[model samples]
Target: MMSQKLAASCHCGSVKFTVELSEGGFDTIRRCNCSFCRMRGAVVVSAPLTGITVLEGQERLTEYRFNTQQAVHFFCSVCGIYTFHQRRSNPEQYGVNVACIEGISPFDFASVDVTDGVHHPSDGSSGGVVGRLLYRPVEKDK
Candidate 1:
């Protein structure tokens, strides 16, 4: 309410996160009907990737990506909390869980345009990712 920083955690509180957000962007929930989302019951309220910051316990998290690993899903490895993910559709956008963050409720659900993830896997052309070897010298680290 008074504080702008939204604190969030897994159901067991093994993992915690904070979002430094602008005044109007906070919401109750966001979601899509894609097979993965439907199964997980995830609602994503997205922001610029730079907006959210993992305050502590980066090592306690796990990543998951399907079809393409570009959209990295970061969750609490201990408690299995679905915190956030890199948007495969818009890799530049940070897909955050609306329920994960503390404070804020659902924005206007009627205006929240849902995407048909069932048809389209992602917005990227081919989920192209460059290898580090392309940039690094051809030598393994000692």
Candidate 2:
């Protein structure tokens, strides 16, 4: 599929970035059922590290690290939006927050695959192989 470029930004527009989508669209969005991800409840799409360019508010971005610390999450200090993160499973790619991307909505996906991140192999804990398939249908106006 042809790659497509999309612009993303924090809730307050403090941090802005552009990402190139290899899948061309939201066809590859996913969710991780890990402690951090589960709590944030974000849908993410992956892109090569080079595919992302920080256009603004670099200094205002804050990082969060834990556990293996391989996966570094970046959020806007102002609006506290989780814009993107370095993937733990694949450090070569970044997981861009789908909600931050312009002109796209999480409700656009018919189903999002939830990875069993709670049982991530790096944690050395036996996280079960179970996965959850989630679907959120948008409610129409009355």
Candidate 3:
């Protein structure tokens, strides 16, 4: 897919930004079973390190790291919402929170690949999908 730019922000709108998706665009979406990711629970799409530009509330952004501390997770301090993260698997790219993207929702995807972050590849293990998340929207009455 062609590269595309999308607006994104935290729940409180305190952190506004733009993300230029990688060549795969939304098709790069996936989830991780890591301790932090499992708790934050955000579906993510891919973007290069330079692809994201924070338009506002730069100071209100906070970062968190765990275990290997290779991946840096960013969130809106004002509303405490996960916005994106530097990928441990690929530091040159980021895994942007799909929910933070305008006009997009985590439920929009039918199925998402769940990577085995518990046994991270960086730790010398062959990381792979452990499961899949399925979204089934209910039918509405006419």
Candidate 4:
């Protein structure tokens, strides 16, 4: 598995950036069933802050913070597309929107595991972050 540089942008193209994908590709993508994430509905892949480079449109990006305000969500003000966010769990990394990455689709994933954001470790809620795994069936040869 070789790491690849991926291009990402907002729906209106007001925001553009590049991210270095992990060698395993979308295998690292995950979803969160937390109040905010459940509504945002974007599958995310992790990348080190150093791996993400905002190429343009930084001024057009809006930031939203809530709860502990540790997690910072970035969205395109013009297109209202969620591009990525600074992970609350790991401040040194980011969760990039899988759908925003060019040449990639969320459907490319066979399944995605949902993190138990409701039971976050920071709050000491327990039960672990691996909440539920959603499966997508592919056609099987007869």
Give the Å shift of residue 73 in candidate 3.
0.6
Q: List the candidates' TM-scores in order.
A: 0.69, 0.86, 0.95, 0.88
lDDT of each: 0.64, 0.85, 0.93, 0.86
Index of the highest-TM-score prediction: 3
Candidate 4, 1-142: lDDT as tens digits: 4367889999999899999865456777899878999899999998878778889999999999999999999999999999999988879888999999998888877778888898887787773557555557778999
User: What's the CA error at residue 128 for candidate 1, in Å?
Assistant: 23
TM-score of 1: 0.69
- lDDT per residue for candidate 2 within 23-129, as digits (tens), equals 54566688988899989989998888888899999999999998888999999999999999988887888899999999877777777878779878666766544
Enumerate clash totals for all models, in the order shown.
4, 1, 0, 0
Which has the better TM-score: candidate 2, or candidate 3? 3
Candidate 1 backbone collisions, by pair = 28-105, 28-106, 30-43, 30-44
State the lDDT at 62 in candidate 1. 88
Count residue pairs with overlapping backbones in model 1.
4
Where is model 1 more than 4 Å wrong at Cα? 1-4, 21-24, 27-29, 104-113, 121-142
Model 3 per-residue lDDT tens digits across residues 9-119: 999999999999988898899999988888989899999988999999999999999888889999999999999999999999999999999999999999999999999
lDDT of 1 by residue, 49-102 (tens): 666767777788888888756778888988787888877777876777776767
